[model samples]
Target chain A: MTARIGIVGAGLIGRAWAIVFARAGMTVALYDVDVTALDKAREAIRQSLVDLKQAGLIEDVEAPLALIQTESDLRRAMADVEYIQECGPENIAAKRGIYAELEAVVDSDTVLASSTSGIAASRFTDQLSHPERCLVAHPVNPPYLIPLVEVVPTPSTSETAVNHTMRLMALAQQAPIMVRKEIQGFILNRLQGALLNEALRLFRDGYVSAEDLDKTVKHGLGLRWSFMGPFETIDLNAPSGVVDYGQRYGPLYRDVDRQRGDDDPWDSVTLAALDKERRERLPSQGLADQQAWRDRRLMALMAHQRTVTPS
Target chain B: MTARIGIVGAGLIGRAWAIVFARAGMTVALYDVDVTALDKAREAIRQSLVDLKQAGLIEDVEAPLALIQTESDLRRAMADVEYIQECGPENIAAKRGIYAELEAVVDSDTVLASSTSGIAASRFTDQLSHPERCLVAHPVNPPYLIPLVEVVPTPSTSETAVNHTMRLMALAQQAPIMVRKEIQGFILNRLQGALLNEALRLFRDGYVSAEDLDKTVKHGLGLRWSFMGPFETIDLNAPSGVVDYGQRYGPLYRDVDRQRGDDDPWDSVTLAALDKERRERLPSQGLADQQAWRDRRLMALMAHQRTVTPS
Candidate 1:
């Protein structure tokens, strides 16, 4: 029998999740409270599928499109699914209400996963009867092109649920990393937040311009990082390995961290200036067009990634 | 006449710089006080050229190889060169002595640039007779593959020198970003240190494993970063643009930064643990092989980058 997957929201992420499951040959029931959102989601999903097909990421868009069924009724979407991915709003109250409704309608055997970027599964699932089956599977934006899904399990989450989610994600051709404990911002966002903090600080201090800082990354660090992680990068950097690398440059990084001190670069004043600088480069009117460009660039990169064999 | 370039200290960075200049059809005179280091650099350059040829980054290895001439004498290497890329050991005193010697040997028209990763140009060039002509043109390691060059000028450095160096780097097909002011760790290392610090904290606190953290980067954040930078990323991420993104997520990042507090994650204990975790995955004996693999992956990525047209 074909596996059934339930997506509990039909927003951007929900629609992307539908493509993911459908591309993996699973029957996806994408549900939403708003009829207009469901309609928009269907159109967006179709456009994305067409983009994916053009990138050679999917063999036939029609096949995947045929597999997904959009429904406005929550119970109808929840019925007969082995797993449910809750893609509701990031608000805790909204998540709580949705999960409660999902639990009341779905079978006890059905695993519940929330697509929260920072909120822990425990926050919403702790009051539920079957909290053991709930976990957080935070994904990068546009999960189809970017394959990383952070599988975070709360203390109430069962080992079986975690294992099942990991297997399912791999089956869907996504890279799943286990976050052993619930931490604020999860893994991906925390790393991004760290870098963003420093970047903001640098720009605020007038040390470097916004454009130059971006150049340093896209043309420098981001190149190696595209293929290898930081640990692997440092491991291969020094003569011996990670230990040698630590001995050589660890102190320098330590000094820099200490020097960073307690300056909060996320202050509104700094952010406003940053926004001003960014606007100077790309006005607000051009954001949608630039976003489309970014998406196309991501698709091209993903397509290229498929051709290269990583050592 | 083809422009001549001098590469002081024929080590890894120096040899890579030789490739950068030579590949651009410049006559590169790679100089080192140690004869053995020069010979080794020659062989390494030849091997790297062959790799570049195989990657289709260069049309012919022999053409670039024939352009690079290794020399044991500094005076001979400095003669008739339009610019000098000093890749000597990262010691202040050594740099001071080398610059003093270089200032005496080179013509007033020649631009003297250093490949010092962190040191500001003023640190060593202040005492030189021609400090105005001296600046830092720091390149990412293996410059031929990763093409970012941070052109940082000291307060004493002249605008002419900075412009000349910028033009030269661009001509070499490198992405050059100007550092408006002298700062610790420049731009790249500071950003890297921030991320590494956060990664260490998460690992030390048992929130995530070393391998998973890396996966979050390589598979998640790194994908978007390869094409678009953090600023541009956030700009496109929100529907409206940078201001919209800041308004929506700025508080969250601020909260995360504030929550981070002043607890230093770069202590010895954390680093040792990080080293242990890394060695377990990539044993010490396999470092050399893995380094080679990293280079090949970088080559493949660069080769792939050439085929894609970024929007």
Candidate 2:
């Protein structure tokens, strides 16, 4: 039997989730309060599936599109669904209100997950009667193309809920990591934040330009990172593996950290400088076109990754 | 007239430089003190060129192969070359000795560059007679495949030398970023180190496993990084631009930074655990095979990149 999944938002992320679930042969019930937003979501999901088919990431768009159904009523959307992925706003009050309404209509057994990037599940889920069944299963933007999901669980979340979420994400072909504790920005954003903080500092200090800094990643460090993570990269770097690599470079990293200090380096002055350079390269008017280019490139990269077997 | 390039040290990196120069229609003089190493380097260069051709990274192997010549005499190898890429040992004494010999043989007009992964150019090039012409042109390992070259200049290096090196790297189809001031690890390793430090902390704290941590990169953050860098990525992320993105997430990044105080977290216990997991995924015996896979994948990615222009 096809599993029924409820998506409780029709924004960009919500539509992407609909495609992911539908493509995986699940019956997706995508719900939105706004009728116009729901209508737009239907068209967007259809176009995204077509894009996936054109990129050779999906076999055919028809079957997946057929599996997705739009629902206007909140109660009907929650009806008979085993799992519900909430893709609402990033506001704590908005999420809390939605959860309160959702808890009343949904079965106690239905696993509830939020797609919040910053807010932790504990903040909002603590108010729910069945908080054990609720957690945060945050997916990267455009989840249909990129397959990283951070499966974060609150303290009240049951083991069963976390395990089931992991299984469902794997079924959808998403690489989900179990984030044991709810850290700020989760794992992806934190790691990204670390890199961005340093990048801003470097740019502000006049060490390198915005263009050159980007080049340093795309052309240099990013090449290896495309296949391996930081740990594995260093693991393969040294002769004796991770320990040897640590011994050689740990102190140097310590020195860098000392120089970095405890303060956040994301100053507005640096951002303005970054914005000026970015605008020079790509104006605001051209952003939509550039984003489309990014999506196409991402699709092509995904297609290429499918061809190579992971080590 | 084709530019002449001299590659000192016929090791793996040296051979890779030979390919980069030769493929760009430059005459290459490859040198090594050991005869057997040079013979092996010649065969390796041939095989790598063949691999690149098979991967569609290069048009034809014959043209590039024709441009490379192995020379036994140091003076003959350095004769009239416009640029000399030194891929010698990381040891200070060894580099100093090589620069002394190279300074005597090579014309003062030639731009001398080292491929040291960690040592700053100022440390080794300080004693040289023509320090103004010397700089560090550190390329990621296997430069024939990866295009990032850190063109680092010492305090004594002249602007003419730096500009010429940048021009030469661009001609060879390698992406070169200028390191305005000499810093530890240059740009690539330092950025990599920051991420590694955080990753170690996460793994040690039991937030995520080694395998899953790598997935967070290869499957998620790394996908976008392979093409556009973090800055450009955030630039296009929000509606307004990078400034808007900063406004939304800068505070969150600040929170994460505070939590991650000044501490070097690459502990031995965590490394041992990571090593164990890595060895399990890729046993020591299987490393050679995995490395081959990595090279092949890099070649394929490079080929793909050629098909699409950066946004």
Candidate 3:
């Protein structure tokens, strides 16, 4: 039997979720507070699927399109669904209110997941009638191409909710990693923040240019990261792999972190300096075009990377 | 005048450096401690360039090969070169001995850069008669394709050395980031280690499977990373970008750091479990074949991605 997925919020993310579930042969019910967002979302889904098909990443879009049922009625959308993916506003108050309503309407067997970026489940779900089913299921933008979904569950979240969400993610073909315990920025955001902070620091210090800094990842470190996790990378990097790599350079990383920990590096000077360099590379007027370029490039790389090692 | 590059250490990395410089229209003179290693290095260079040419990542290979010179005399290789990239074994004793030899031969204007992965310049360069010309120019395993070279300069090193090396790297078509001060693991390794340690922790806590953990990156986080550094990603991730993302998740990352501090989850039990899963997905006997497949997949994806946003 096909699993039914109820997505509340017919924005791009919600529609992407719909496409994801529908592509994986699951029934998707997409609902939104406003019908206008729903209409735009529907159009976006069609355009996105066409693009995916052209990229040879999707097939049977017609069926998934047919499986999508759009409705403004929240209760109607929630009925009989095994999983409810809440893509409502990232507002804590909004989430709080929605959880209370969702708890009353959502079946006990159903898993209720939020698309919130960083709000703790324990805080939002605490007031819910069925709080155990609530947690964060943050996906990177354009979920159709980028599959990273950070799954963060609170102590109040039931094991069953987590399992149900995980299975749903699996069936939807989304790659999800549990946050284990709630913390700031989740994993991706934290790691990204740390890197950005350092890169910003370097830029601020006039150690490297913005273009060089960006290329440093795109052409350099990114090549391995696209294929191997950081661990597997170090594991295979040295003659003896990880241990040898650690013995030789662990102290350096430790020191970098230590200096990084210090260095009162966070200041307006750094951000503005970075902003100027970024604007120079991509002015405000051109940022949008550059972003589109980024997306298309990502698609191309994904297609290529899927076929070979990055080197 | 053509930029002359001297590679003193005809090991795999050294030879690869020669190809990188030669392909970029620089005259390359490669020297090795062992004559046999020199011969082996030539064969490796031949095969590697063939692959590069096949990939269309290189041009003028014939000329580059002709420009390639081999010698056991360290002084002769550095005679005409303006920049020297040393890729000797990553041992203090080895570097100390090599530096003394290089110092005696190279003019003060020549920059002596070590390709050592871990040891600081101060560790070995302190003994050099011309230590100002010495610094750590660490590259990821392969510099030709993945162009991230972390340039670390000791306190005693001259700023001119950094500028000269950066200019040479730019000419060589590499993405170089300068560490204002020597730090561990440079940028790439530390970011990698941080991610892997967390991934291990997630697995240890029974949050997810190894395959899923791997997918969480390849299909998820890495897709964005292939183009943008971690910060730029968050900068564009939220409506307001990086700052907004920080406001939302920065505290959480700090909290995670607090809980996860001192937890080296990549310990024995976690390794055993991960190894078990990895073996199941890819048996030990099939490691070689699987690796080949992985390489191919990465190539295809890279090709596709390059044409789009991946490159």
Candidate 4:
């Protein structure tokens, strides 16, 4: 049975979600509050689908594009949809209103998931009668290019909902990881946050330049990171395995941690300095071109990734 | 004029350095204290060069292999070498002893650098007759595959040595980042240590599983990090650039950092748990095979990187 997916906001993420599901042969109903945004979304999604086809990421883009139906009417979009991915505003009151209307319209069995980056589902779903179906299904930006989806559930979210979402994501060719509990920034951002914290400090202290620090990742740590994680990186570092690696380097890490000291790692002065450096390299006006460059690189990487099989 | 490079230790890093310099058209003299290790280094280096050639990373393995000469005597290897990369043991005494010998044999114009992972160059080079020419030229394991070389200089190290080393590294097609001041673990490992520290804590607290955390990177953040750094990622993340990204998410990172608390993030309990998980996924004996797999993936990524122009 082909499942129907509802995207309740025709913004960047909502439209991306539409492509994700549509590409998987699911029927996607994309809705937005503004009629103009919905019209714009249709053209943008069409162009994006073609781009994916050109990149060899998808074959026969018209089939997926045909699967997505853009509608301005919220209730019509929600009706009979087995899953609703809310991509609305991040505000609590705004989400509460959206959820209230969604709860009234969608069936009891419909799984409601928020594409919120950090907001816990419970905060907004607490008042809903069907909170069991509500959870956070956060995808890294530009989900069509990146495949990771963080499925974070609230206390009230049902196992059925979480499992359904996970399975659906997998079917959509997305790699979904469970977040057992809620924490600020979730796993992806937290890890990124940790790295950024140190990077900012390093730049602030004049230990390394912003460009060099960027090189440290692009040309160094990130090469391994693209395919292997931190734990796996060390697991293969030593001959014996992870335990051997930990035994050898744990103390060094501990020593560095202590030396790192407990200070507010993020400060405005450092950010300003970093901003100046970044802007000098990439002027704000050239951001769109740079983003397109990033997208192209991502497509190339994903294409290359498909050719290699990991042991 | 092509520089003649001397490798003091024929270990994993030494052999990898041989490929890096040799492939860049530099004549390499590889030496080790133990004659057996030197022989082993030659075989390993030859095999590695062939692998890189097979992976299409190098055009002709024989050319680079022919450029590398294995020597059992230290002075013979050091004589007339324009640059010496010491891949000695990561212990202070061992490195100091090696540096003392190198100090006597190498010319004053020759730049002496250590491939020590953790030990500071200043610690070993402090008492040398010419401390100005000595610094840390730390490369990621398998420099031919990973091009990042953290060129760290001590307080007494001369600008001439730093610039010379930097130019040589760039000439060797390795991305070299300057570490203005000596710090523990330098920039690469410290940033890695910071990420690993939180990863340990997160796994310990059961916020996410070891595999999931790894997935969070390989499938997500690492994709971008593979080419762009955290600062650049955020710079493009928001329309207005780094300052804009900082303004929007700086508070969130700060909040997460506060919630992170000061208790040491690396605990033994978590390492054990992580080890179990890693060993389960990849058994103790399978590490070497997995490492080869990682190398193949890295080569594929590098090949793909060469196709695109970084904006």
Candidate 5:
């Protein structure tokens, strides 16, 4: 029998998840209470499929489109589903209510995964009868193009559930990393937050401009990071490996960290200034157009990546 | 007459700078005290030019190769040079000595730029006769492949020198970002250190493995960052712009930052363990091969970037 997957929200992330599962040849039931949201999701998914097809990422968009079924009724959409990916609002109340509804319909063996970027599964699933089956499977936006899925398990999350989610993510052609313990913002966001904190501090202190800082990443560090992680990058950087790299530059990094004393709150004033600078470069009205351009650039990069093998 | 450029030291970075200048149609004089190091640099530069040619980055290998001249005498290399890129050892004493000799030989109009990653130009140039012509123009490992050059000026550096260096960098086809003030690690390394500090702490605390952390970056954050910087990324991410993104996620990042209290020292035990983990995946003997592979991947990426227009 074909595996059935239930997506509990027909929003942006929910629709993207639908494409991911449908592309993997799984039956996807995308559910939402709002008929307009469901209608918009269907159109958006169709457009994304066409984009993917044009990027040479998909063989036939129609096949995947045919596999996804959108329904306004939650229970009807989740019927006989082996796994449920909750893509509800980030609010705790909304997540709890949706998970409660999902638990009432899902079978005993169904794995419950939330796509919440920051919230832990325990917060929403503690009162449930089967909290052991719940975990967080956070993904980057537009998961069909970017394949990383951070699988974070709470203390109550069972080992079996984690394994099942990992296997399912791999089957869906996504890169899944296991977070052994639940941490704030998970792995990817924490790393990003770390970099952003420093970037904000630098920009605020007048060390560099926002545009120049972006250039530093896109042209410098980001180039290496695009292919290798920091560990691997440092490992290959020095003569011997990571140990040698640490011996050579670890003190410098330590000094820089020491210099960065106290986690200063991201002030609104600095953010406003940054926003103004960004607007000067790209006005508020041109944001949507820039976003579209960003997506196209991402598509082109993905296409290019597929053609070359990682060293 | 063709513009004459002098490159001090024939080490890895120096040779790369030689290639950068030579490929820009300048007559490059690469200087090193040791004859054997100069000989090695010539062969390495030739090999790199061939690699660049194969990657379709340059039209012809011999054109650039023929433009570079190796010299053992510092005075001979500095003769009639328009700009000098010093790639000597990163030691303060060594830098001070080299600058003294360079000041004695080079013309007053010639700009002196150091390729030092951490040391500020003011530290060594303070004693020189023409401190106004000296500044730090740090580059990534291989300047020919990675185009970013951090054009950092000391307080004493003249506006003419900064403008000349910036124009020179642009002429050489490199991306140069101005550093308004002197700081530890400048921009790129500080940002890198911030991320690595968080990564090390996470690994030490047993939240995630070295391998998984890398995947979270290379596959997730890196995919977007490869083309755009974090600032531009956040700008395009939200509906309005950067301010919208900040309003939505700034608190979450601040919470994460606050939770990361105290800049803990990167312990040796953790680094050893991390190194062990990396060596298990890539043994000590394979480091050189991996580095070569990284370069090839970089070349391929650069070639791909040249073909596409950034949005």
Candidate 6:
């Protein structure tokens, strides 16, 4: 009686999704165009499950991996599946082809979700016969550790599509948010862009060094942001809270926005400075080791969050 | 042999700062224009210290509170102090007047820093004879738990003033970042604004609910961000890590910026939706209690972070 899920494109993201779904007690049918990719993806998914098990993230991993089956036929993956997660490439033409193929074969009750970051659901769903079920359930990279899945819909998309997608995502052990309309980068990407843009502006203007700039977030504002949003954080900022903090500091942010009109810091001077500072702190050779350490650290953090709060 | 740190205001930030400096083993002299404010501030500081003790944030409250001495005279607060942290009103006229008064009283060797969030250092330090000693030392709302202090300097400001202030902040158990030149909103505010701005845009454009927007951060990015920074986070994102992740997603972020023209959803509407969601999640009458819960949760999270990670 468990929900049966189908995942197209058994690459890194697709395999990750397979793990997520299978870990949540859903039988996943993962498919790829090439049989070689399907073979490799199965091994990768197994290895990743082992990693997750080692990190104490998953239990009964062998059962989940055993539940995931690969079929030579594309339509075989979607047959009798309650949900389908499409982690196809960013190309519009490829997505169109896949959608067309999927629409022709996917079950009427199946929720067809795209893992696309930028493409609007309307872009491809405009031609779909069952466009109501088509939406973007884009997840941040390494979705297991970071569980923000942006569920963006189009005008043709139905409310049931949104709710069912959310419910199915919950079953997958992912936090799903509905995007009422289609936007460029969804939510997480755009929010992330804002920070990167401002960091670049500060560096380009020669206001701070790259290392200190990063530290400003890691040691300072980030300390609070790790727990609360900007709005809630601002609320507790002043005596009267949000309104007071806004009245005092809104003008300052407005001025900053004014001063930061269309400035790109990827130029030679700024890049050189960034490289210089980056080299001083993190060597190119040690980048790999540092990254492994970061992943381990993230694993530890995730373990802490899971045990302290709810996983 | 300890740093003689003089604070010009006795408000919450200033008092918490007194605890920070005193706990770090320094002589903190506090002064206020109104004795009534000072008296109330004393009670508030004592209560806060007790709360910190209860929260296990501070170890010895009595000794730290004992290190603070009240002075009625401006010269007494300004004289012979290694560093002066000005936490007066953010109004330009008030700061200008204080700068003039402190200029007449403070020795040239003493560094004069402000806790102003809005006004630039150049604006208030324009007419001061020793403007070289003036700089911005902005901190988060509660400086004790959150240790980020943004140090801003004008073009005419001396390097020695910057270095001395940095050293002094270090002595106070604060992580200070020096803004090489004055820019709007400094580092933390701008980065935060960037994220909030994009969130506002996504909401205004009918992309996501306000609650979902906040969760995108709190659950998604905030998980790792609580421990590492955006740059460091990105560095470990891809195979080659940050540089690789940047190369992959940087262009995509730029494209997102290009698409967010003035056609997004409005903040007021989103805020209304957020308020509605907030009320549903927690009764409006219990907001104050919820905020206490939030702080306790933060403390628990911090404690968990310590047990999980070394740094």
TM-score of chain B of each: 0.98, 0.97, 0.93, 0.97, 0.98, 0.92
Highest-DockQ candidate: 5
Candidate that beats the other on TM-score, 4 or 6, i.e. the better one:
4
Q: CA lDDT of A30 in candidate 5?
A: 93
Q: What are the Cα lDDT values of the candidates?
A: 0.87, 0.89, 0.72, 0.88, 0.90, 0.76
Residue pairs clashing, model 6: A179-B207, A207-B180, B204-B264, B204-B265, B204-B266, B205-B264, B205-B265, B234-B242, B235-B242
5 or 6, which is superior by TM-score? 5
Worst 10 residues of 3 chain B by lDDT: B302-311
| Ranked by lDDT, top first | 5, 2, 4, 1, 6, 3
Interface RMSD of each: 1.5, 1.1, 3.9, 1.2, 1.1, 2.9
TM-score of each prediction: 0.97, 0.97, 0.85, 0.98, 0.98, 0.89
Q: What is the per-residue lDDT of model 1 for residues B186-241, given as tens digits with 9 covering 90 to 100?
A: 89988888888788888889988888889899999998888778999988898877
Model 3: lDDT to the true structure: 0.72
RMSD per model, one decimal: 1.5, 1.4, 3.8, 1.2, 1.2, 3.2
> Model 3, B60-147: lDDT tens per residue?
4577788888888887778978889999888899888888888788887799899987678899988766788889888876677667
lDDT digits (tens) for residues A167-275 of candidate 3 = 7776677777777777656666555544555565666666666666676676666766677665555545545444455565555554555555534444556556666
Across B171-213, the per-residue lDDT of candidate 2 in tens digits comes to: 9999999999998888887788777778888888888888888
**lDDT minimum window of 10 residues, candidate 1 chain A:** A254-263
Quickly count the clashes in candidate 5. 0
TM-score of the A chain in candidate 6: the value is 0.93
Candidate 1 segments exceeding 4 Å error: none
| Candidate 6 lDDT tens digits, B1-311 | 47888998898778878877887888888989888888887788787778777767678779888888877688877668888888888789998888888888878768889998767889998788888888999987667767789999887789999998888888777889988877677788888876766776665556666678777887677766776777767766666645556667777766655565333233345445555555565555665765666666666665655565443
Provide the lowest-lDDT 10-residue window in model 6 chain B: B261-270
Task: Identify the superior model by TM-score, candidate 3 or candidate 5.
Answer: 5
Better of 1 and 4 by TM-score: 4
Candidate 2 interface RMSD value? 1.1
Instruction: Supply every candidate's count of residue pairs whose N, Cα or C atoms clash at under 3 angstroms.
Output: 0, 0, 36, 0, 0, 9
Docking category of candidate 4: medium
**Model 3, runs deviating above 4 Å:** A53-56, A59-64, A126-135, A152-163, A178-185, A197-211, A259-269, A306-311, B54-64, B126-132, B153-164, B180-184, B193-213, B254-302, B309-311
Candidate 5 displacement at residue A178 in angstroms: 0.6
Off by over 4 Å in 5: A263-265
- Model 4, B1-311: lDDT tens digits are 47899998888889999999999999999998789998898889888878888888889978888899999888898889999999888889988888888888888778999998888889999998899999999999889889999999999999999999999999999999999998888999989988888888889899999999999999999999999988889999997888888888888877656766555755667778898898788877788788889988888888888877865
